[model samples]
Target: MITAQNLTKRFGAHTAVDDVSFTIKPGQVTGFLGPNGAGKSTTMRMIMGLDRPTHGSTTVNGRPFGEHTDPMRQAGALLDAKAAHPGRRAADHLRLLAATNGIARSRVDDVLELTGIASVARRRIGGFSLGMHQRLGIAATMLGDPEVLIFDEPVNGLDPEGVHWVRGFAKARAAEGRTVFISSHLMSEMAQTADHIIVLGKGRVLADAPIAQFLGGAGQERTRVRVSDATVLGSILSADGVSITQTDAESLEIAGLPPAHIARRAALENLDLHELTPLNASLEEAYLALTDDATEYRSDRTAVAA
Candidate 1:
């Protein structure tokens, strides 16, 4: 497991990470989410010992990353895809890392094949594409076979197939009881891959809970309904706490009332109900709502001249 307690970081006058704290337990995939400049990368860097925290502490498997005798074997991270030298061959880079970490050279081939880059093992790093670079970086992280895996935008340059592979790989690792922590802007992918979520905003943790709880707590549960007498049914359902939005001439989106209650009310009113479907909030919607105020960069939604 990875733990951060009151973790903080500052660069010059600006604080990047502010008193952040969260626990990434094993046996599950925890997604780290935030808007731009929310200090996610900074927190990951602190955990990897790439940058020193100005205050508080972070640990991997109960100790600082640098304190581990075999750091690579304890925790593996893919912070940057271009960390390897451009002059080195893909296989050479892995061999060098393995040699330093006392890992067998055979393990290099295993990871290269595992990441589906074995065919390009002899190629120079400078000639690799962005997707290939990401695969190579994943291969490096796997060379140690660490129990804790930290990936920062692992699918940044991947294709759809690559993204699917990564999602399955993360889940498989977690199934094996390894701690998997991933940071990505792909909400749809995170919704499918992560079992839990940790949201950061304005350099502080805003939400940390299971995916279902996070979504449920971000906004009220909405139900979509269609009936023969939509206008009259909406009027009957409208109340002090209930919200009813007329989506169309025949349908309505409602909140603050259960489906059973709406059905019962419609039955009592003799309204012909065609549909009553609960709308589960998407991760993107929940993230946007929770971090609405924490977003540092806001883009104008005004339409431009055609």
Candidate 2:
């Protein structure tokens, strides 16, 4: 498990991460989400001991990352895929890391095969594509066979097949009772990949909960109702605190009321109904609602370019 207690980081006058606290439980894939410059990378660096926190602390198990006897075996991280020397061969790079950490050289081949990059194991890093570099980075992380894994933007340059492989790999690790914390900007992928989610904006945590709860727990339930006479049903359904949006001439998107309530209301009014569908708030919707005010950058598009 990974535990962060009031973690904070400051660079001169600017605060990058502000008193953030959260837990990444084992046997689960926890997604770390945020907009650009929202402190996701800063927090991951602090957790890996790459940067010291200005206040509070983050621990892998019960100790800081620097205090671990076998740091790589305890927690492995892929913060930057390009951290290795660009001239070195992929296999040689993994060999060097294993040598420094007293890991057996055989583990190098194991990870190379595991990450599906063994075919190009002898190729130089500079010649590898962005996707190949990502695979090589993941191979390095698995060299330690660590119980806790941290991946920052692991799918940045991956194709569809690679992304699918990563999703399955993360869940497989969690199934083995390992702590897997991944940070990404892709909400649709997170909706399918993560079991729990932590959202950050403006250097602070905005929300953290299970994926299911995070998607539906924040806003009012919306029900889409298409009636035969939306013009007549509009005034009849309009009441105090009940919001209704007319989607079309004959369709209305209703909120602040249950589907059953809308159906009963239509029945009592003797109105014909065509569609009564309950629309669940998607992850993208929930994320936008949560971070609307927290977004640091906003664009005012007053002009269009041809």
Candidate 3:
């Protein structure tokens, strides 16, 4: 498991990571999410011992990452896909890492095959494509077969098949009781891959909870109601706190009310209901709502003349 207690980092006069505390337990995939400049990379760097925290502490498997005798064998991270030497052959690079970590050379081939980059293992890193680089980075990360896996944008340049494989791979690793923590801007993939989520904004954690709880808490529940007379049903549902929007001639989307309450009120009014479906907010919607004020950069949506 990985733990961070009051972790903080600062560069010169700017604080990148604030007093952050989180526990990434084993047997689960925890997704790290945030807008740009939210200090996610800084936190990950601290966890990997690449950057020293200005205050607080972080540990991997109960100790600081650098304190581990065999750090690679305890935790593996893919912070940057271009971390390897551009001139080295992929296989040779993995072999070198294995040698330094006292890992068997045969394990390099195993990871190469596992990441589906065995065919290009003998190729120079400089000639590899971005997708190939990501795969190679993942191969290097698995060379030690560490129990804790940290991947930052593992699917950045991957194709659909590669993305699917990575999603499944992360889930599989978590299923085996390994600590899997991933940071990505892909909300859809993260929604499917993560059991829990940690959202950071402006160097502070905004939300940390199970996927369902986070989604449910981010926005009000909405329901779609289809009736014979959309106008009449909308009028009937409108109240001080309730909001109703005419989605179509025959349907109304509602909020601030439950489906059962709507159904009962419709029954009391003897209005025939065709459909009353609850609209669960998507992960993207929830994320946007939660981080709407937290985003450091905002783009204008004004239309431009051709």
Candidate 4:
């Protein structure tokens, strides 16, 4: 398990992580979520002993990361997939890391095969694709067969098949009682992969809870309605304390009102309804709503004349 005690990190006057505290338990996959510049990377760096926290502490398996005699055997991370030497062969890269921690050279081939990159293991790193690089990085992380694994954006450059493989692999690892923590912007994947979630905003811990609880509560239910006149339906729903977003000419997504209420309103107004569907609140929607205020780089885009 990984634990953080009021973890705080500051660079000069700029604080990156602020009094954040949480525990990542074993036998479960925990997701780390945050908006850009919300200090997700900084916190992970501190846990890996790459960055010194200005205050507080973090530990892997009950002791500081630096104090571990065999750090690779305790915890392994894949923060940067392209951090390997570009000139080295893929297998050579894993061999180098394994040598540092007294791991057998045979383990290098094992991980390469496990990651499905064994065919390309003899190729130079510089010639690998983005997805191949990610595979190699994952292979290196598993070189020591650590009990704790942390992956940052593991699916960033992967194809659909690769993404599916990672989701299954992470869950399989957790089922084996390993501590698995992953950070990703792909909320849909996280929704499927993680059992629990920890959200950070503005360098503070916004929430830490099970996936179901985190996506539940207020503003959880939203419905989509398809009518002959979406504009009129939107106006009617808006006046009744419902928020409406016109998706297209015939469809409007309504929030703050149940599907039954919407159907009743449509019947009362003699509105021609084609469809009235209850839309599930997705993890993407929840993340955007929770971190709307914490987003660092806000965009203001407007249509331009052709």
Candidate 5:
């Protein structure tokens, strides 16, 4: 277990984390989410004791990270997958970490096997691809068989299969009663994997809730309607509780009306309907809506492209 209590950090005058608090428990995968400048990496650094917080504190289990005996054996962190010495051999790197922590040398090979990097263990890390580097990072994190694991953007450079593998691996670790905390900007990927979510914006915690609650962000129900004569059918259904928007010449995006009521209304008006589907607010849509104000730099690129 890990708890961040009013964790705040500042660089000079700019406050990065703004009194954030959260608990990550074992036996569940918790996803940490925020936009690019939302202070996620800084928070992770504080948790790993790499960055001194300007105020407040974070702890693993019940003790501050700096106070933990055999810190690597207690909590493993991968802040950046490629944050390794480029000249070091992968196997030697793992061995050095294991040696420093008094973890068994055999554990190095075990993690190598666990992360599927045994074949390339002797290769220089500089020659490794991003996917291979991710594998090495995971191998390093598992060197001590730590009970708490933190991964920041673990899936950033992986292919689809690699993404699936990491998702499964994180879930498996949590199943063994170990805490797994993952941070990523991909909401759809997180929605498929995380049991709970913590959303951040403007260096503050915007929302913290279960995955279901977080995924349901500020959007009303929408229904898709298809008809052969969309013009006539849309006018017929546009009576009171329905505002029909043309999806195409033949399809209608209808909202504020139940499917059954829409069908009944269509039937009474003798309309030819073909399809009816509800367009729920997906995790991606929710994330976009949540960060609408934070995307300042994008407007410039969009305008230039326009």
Candidate 6:
């Protein structure tokens, strides 16, 4: 398991990550999500010990990453695919990593097959496409055969098939009882791949909870009702503390009011209704509502800090 305790960092005067804390349980894929410049990469970098935190720390398997006996064998990470030497062959790069960590050379072939890049392992890194590079990076990470795997935006350039493959690979890693922590800026991808989600914005954690709890627990239980007579529904919903919005000419999106109240109101007023239905918010909707304020754009602010 991975645990972060008050992890924080400041670059000069600007704070990047502010006292963020969370747990990544084993046997599950936990997604890290945030908007652009929301300090996600900074936090991930701190976890990998690439940058020292200004305060607190994050631990993998109850110890700092740098302190591990075999850091690469204990935890493998791909902070950036472009960080590798461009002139080197894919297989040579993996071999160098394995040699540095004292990992067996045979594991190199295993990861090559695992990531589906063995066919192009002889090619130079400069000639690989984004998807191919992603695969090679995964191969490098898996060379250690680590118990903890951290992939940041692993599907950035992958096609639909490659995306599905990476998703399955993440689940397979967890099935082997490894701690799989994947980070991406895409909420849609996270919704499909993550068992739990950690939302961050403006150097702060907005929400950290299970996928079900986040979808079912965070937002209001609102219903979408469609009627032939939107005017009548609008008049009925104008009462105190009752919220309603006109979704279309013949439809109304109602919330903060129960379906029975709407039904009875329509019946008593002698109005004809076409449909009365509840519409629960999806993960995308919940995310937008939660991060509406944390968005980088603001009209009132004099200057944007980030």
Full-model lDDT, candidate 5:
0.87
lDDT tens per residue, model 1, 122-230: 9999999888999999999998899999999999889999999999999999999999999999999999999999999989999999998898776777999999888
Tens-digit lDDT track of model 3 for 229-257? 88987887789988899989889999999
Our model 6 lands, by Cα RMSD against the true structure, at: 4.1
Residue 221, candidate 2: alpha-carbon lDDT: 83
Off by over 4 Å in 5: 225-233, 236-242, 246-252, 258-277, 301-305
Worst 10 residues of 5 by lDDT: 292-301
Cα lDDT for residue 195, model 3?
98
lDDT of 4 at 59: 96
Candidate numbers sorted by TM-score from highest down:
3, 1, 2, 5, 6, 4
Pick by TM-score: 3 or 4, better one:
3
Q: Give lDDT tens digits, candidate 6, residues 1-306.
A: 888899899989998899999989999999888777788888888888899999998998889998998988889898797777989998899899889889988998899999998899898999999989888888888887888999989998999999999999998898899999888866778888899988988889999998888887656667777776887778867877667889787788887887888888878877777798876677788887888877775455456544
- The lDDT values for all models are 0.94, 0.92, 0.93, 0.90, 0.87, 0.86
lDDT of 5 by residue, 1-306 (tens): 999999999899888899999999999999988787889899999999999999899999889989998998889999888888999999998999988899999998999999988999999999999999998999888987889999999998889998999999999999999999999877778978899888878778877888777764457667898877788877876767567799687798887777888788778777777898877777778877887786534546578888
**Which candidate comes out best when scored by lDDT?**
1
Model 3 Cα shift for residue 50 (angstroms): 0.5
Cα deviation of 46 in candidate 1 (Å)?
0.6
C-alpha RMSD (angstroms) for model 2: 2.5
How much lDDT does candidate 6 score? 0.86
Model 2, 1-306: lDDT tens digits are 899999999999999999999999999999999888899999999999999999999999889999998988999899998888999999999999999998999999999989999999989999988888888988989888999999999998899999999999999999999999999988899899999999999889999999988887768888888998887788888988888999788899988888999899899988999999987788889998899888887666465332
Give the winner by TM-score.
3
Candidate 4 per-residue lDDT, tens place, 9-51, comes to 9888998999999999999999999998999999999999999
**After superposing candidate 3, which stretches have Cα over 4 Å from the reference?**
271-274, 303-306
Model 4 bad stretches (over 4 Å): 218-279, 301-306
> Cα deviation of 40 in candidate 1 (Å)?
0.6
TM-score of each: 0.93, 0.90, 0.94, 0.83, 0.86, 0.83
